[model samples]
Target: MNALMAPFGGWNMPIQYAGIIAEHNWCRTKAALFDICHMGEFIFQGDFESGGLEDVFTFSVKSIPLGRSRYGFLLNEQGGIIDDLIVFRIAGDKVMIVVNAATAPKDFAVIRGRLRGGLFTDITAATGKLDLQGPLSRDVMVKLFGEAVAAIPYFKFITMNILGVEAIISRTGYTGELGYEIFIPAEKVCELWDLLLSDERVKPAGLGARDVLRLEVGYSLYGSDIDEETTPLEAGLEGFVNFDKTFVGKEALLRVKEQGVTRQKVAFEVAGRRSPRHHYDICSAEEIVGNVTSGVFSPVLGRGIGIGFVRPELSAIGTPLTINHERVSMEAVVCDLPFFKDGSVRA
Candidate 1:
């Protein structure tokens, strides 16, 4: 139960419990329970268009079927990302928006400013979220929740009663593993956490391990890999943007697409155990091309791996690069996404 604590998104949170590497390995092989209550959740009720909700994000809100969720972005006028979020069609006239912990306040302000109608409420304080992730997560969830838990597919969700309260059990997660994110009333979350941990297959993981897991799968960290200065196109996430839809940043994005993005996000694998740290210089032939955004000594790969933004011409797979910071330098190679490819995310 002893854990290393650190400050994150204005909350004192656990950085690690048993250990970061151990927890990361456990999440890859078995179920790892993460206390993710710090994430922000918002509820919107009203007409999707009349409330100005349909035009708020890069993806189409009205097109999402009920009981399903869609991942996309909110952007500024210059097409810079405001926040990357997931929208859930919880009911006919109601939807839930889940966003990053640190960007919650700003995201709320930006979203509310754009909305001319609708009842918008921040439900983060009242909601508690826990991520149960790993290859065996499906089996563990089915045993505790019900047979229905096993039936939920990727990116889908269903409301179920747990601990005498209605909860949303979504088959979605950040780790590249078969997982579920459970949202329940704040008061009952601890009870459910305790009950889940009582099972032998589940262990506690923390933000430190979570970071490594997400990065290994090539998922961007909002503040690190992508931020207000970056657009989805530049981040290689054009698939999440629907240009046919009218959005706040559509014009700027179109312009960027026409002119071409100056820099692009790239994933690389280090040749050794030396970890690449944030802000480390990425170079080719002794010239700096970009900087590392997120890096770690990957337990699964047994080597250093990192994500960074580089000139578009330098992002090709198999390109040789050097990651340098002060006296530290290491060899790296531009590689295809998902530095770790054996995950059971879709299996």
Candidate 2:
């Protein structure tokens, strides 16, 4: 696999293999395998209440049923997002925290400081992750693994034996397709990767195709769409935040709610083939309202789709705007998310 490699989150990552568009299309029609070993994993074991784990994130950890996972944010004192991550309830008292690779160190330190009694450990060096996504993903997994893989519902996971070792197969994915994220031992990742690609229906995809796939479905990229300076409210991710929970940033978020958000996240579609790039100015009329956070030419829609922050008044659907970068300019309009809505994500 002669993949074009690039630096991402302090690691040399594959940008594309074959071609970005080809790989993206393959994933839409068949299963696409992704090497997601760069993601960080942490294990926490203790009492949710006594260990102070319940208040660590925007969602309640104790309330997460066993064998299920929940997505939410970790906020700083100012109510700004530190990172958006998922917590998997592995057992009654043990949970696994999955986070972005680049923020692993900071996320671990912050989480440790907040905990009083839980036994927390960074398992990134020992854990490996792989994602198989598309409408055919479940079939591929079932054939390779067992019927157990076919039983997992969305957001649920089960521990099963693979390659003579325990592995977690979760029915969750970044692409808006029926898929699974498999967590296994780091030592066996190479073997697992080879095994999955051996299937004729499965093709390897790189981060380049992965980015376009996620953006098409309106999934926010960590460093791009949401970051430490961006609050969940402004990012339109407040649904993941539980206001009843007494989290670290509750007071600040309450304050923000009262004051209202100054800017809000919006999705837009370009009128032509011209792509919008990051940092491109988002203009309403003649005034620049915000900048593009993430943008790409969507193959599914045959147009450019982007996610960016803009003034609230300029974020309504059908609001006309201009995307400008240096000498490049394109006409665009605010649109609903999931630009490609006919995905098999729920099916």
C-alpha local distance difference test of each model: 0.95, 0.94
Give the Å shift of residue 31 in candidate 2: 0.4
lDDT: worst 10-residue window of model 2 = 6-15
lDDT of 2 at 273: 88
Cand. 2 TM to true fold: 0.99
- Residue-wise C-alpha lDDT for candidate 2, range 116-196, written one tens digit per residue: 997999999899999999999999999999898888999999999999999999999999999999999999999999999
Prediction RMSDs, each to the true structure: 0.6, 0.7
* Tens-place lDDT digits, model 1, residues 255-293: 999999999999999999999989999999999999999
C-alpha lDDT of candidate 1 relative to the true structure: 0.95
Off by over 4 Å in 1: none
